[model samples]
Target: MNMVEHPGFVLWFTGLSGAGKTTIAVALEAQLRERGMRLERLDGDTVRQGLTRDLGFSKEDRDKNIERVTFVAKLLSRNNVAVLASFISPYIAHRDGVRAETTHFIEVFVDAPLEICAQRDVKGMYKKAFAGEIKNFTGVSDPYEPPINPEIHIHTDQETVDESVQRIVTWLEERQYIPAKVTA
Candidate 1:
């Protein structure tokens, strides 16, 4: 389907905090850059700090945040940029809304146990949530609904960063979104 000519698409990564969504997204972005692809990365934490600073963590606010991100990602894709997003978009309806807005939406579920994620709290988010410093936190005070049928399921516990990146890159190539290396 000549994805490159159609402005590429979005690779949406969803999961609980510390689930390695941002880690995988960053690795994939670096790999894609190495392959000379135009790309944009939108991580939920960073987005909230800037574009969605005023938004709270309420269900409505979360939905609105995802809606804004979906629009921005779709626009970037329409301009021939591969948009990669890492967010804990915790609702089926919100994810479906994003899918409806973009033609090439690849949902990558970063599936990791809450206990594992809590242990790997690189940013101290889990600690804050557990201490009641952060309210409405997914997998803690709030809920995290897993994807019913994600395009790819990345179990961070079982795979290394390189392996995860390779899996995603292979998916892009197999789906014809990117060119494959020619056999000698």
Candidate 2:
């Protein structure tokens, strides 16, 4: 198949807030860009300010947020643009719904224990959630539904960003969604 002539796949990275979902996605995006592939990223924090500003952190709001992002990803992927999404979409139903919405979807579970995520929280989300200052926070007050049999699973706490990105890249290459690495 001519990957360049066909629509690209949707890559969904899901995990806790500090589980390095965005970090790995950003690194993967950089790697994809370096290889001359056209891709777009839709991050939770970045989209919340625009696409989902009216939504809150409630369960319904979270589902709606995922729906919106999935809608956008569907459009882009249909047009041959690789849509990379980094979200703490803590619901399995919604994630599955997103998978159904795209032509090709890869669910990447960025895994890290809650303790490690808490330690990596630079925004103090974990601290605030632990202190009762934040409600409905995944891995704290709220719940996180880990991906069941995800396409790729990366333990961010156990791997560096580059390693995580390489894992994702390898998956894409194996499926021919992106070109394989060329040797010098």
Candidate 3:
């Protein structure tokens, strides 16, 4: 599987915290890797620990965060590396900026009700946000502007992870972004 034969693209997964953005991205990454694609997964939490460690959660800081990630994704995707990015990128403008900067950018909206996301919060961040302990939290103190038209929309509350991944993979194949899976 020569990666150069496959064009690079960026799969940007955006949703509320605890909405399974990272979970689905991880599953999709593994499936793509099994196909022998050159890939990289840029996660919000992980990137925050390194690349954007100096940034905070404010809107200005958040914009800066996405801008930095967009730069990295642009470089990787242009070089034939599949980029899987999962983030709680709440602003439409910021996401649009990424789409403009990256190559073959696909916006994947991981949709789930706020209540459902709150229930899935094992880290208690949502609880704190709801209680006013955590300030500037998207969907609580801050606003999360959902995508007007995402390339892929996954309902995390209704769909299983496998189902979501299959849907995404099928889309990529249909669009000729990725080759169809070869089964034995």
* CA RMSD of each candidate after superposition: 2.9, 2.4, 1.2
Candidate 1: minimum summed lDDT over ten consecutive residues — where?
1-10
TM-score, structure 2 vs. true: 0.94
Those runs of model 2 whose alpha carbons end farther than 4 Å from true positions after fitting are: 1-6, 182-184
- Candidate 1 lDDT, tens digit per residue, 9-50? 899999998889999999888767766677899999899999
Query: Model 3: per-residue lDDT, tens digit, 150-181?
Result: 99999998999999999999999898888666
| Whole-model lDDT values for every prediction | 0.88, 0.88, 0.93
Residue 169, candidate 1: C-alpha displacement in angstroms: 0.8
Instruction: Please tell me which model should have the higher lDDT, number 2 or number 3.
Output: 3
- In candidate 2, what are the lDDT values of residues 36-149, reduced to their tens digit? 677899999999999999999999999899999999999999888998999999999999999999979999999999999999886888889999999899999999999989
Query: TM-scores for all candidates?
Result: 0.92, 0.94, 0.96
- Candidate 3: residue 32 lDDT (0-100): 90
Q: Cα deviation in Å at residue 149, candidate 1?
A: 0.4
lDDT of 2 at 90: 97
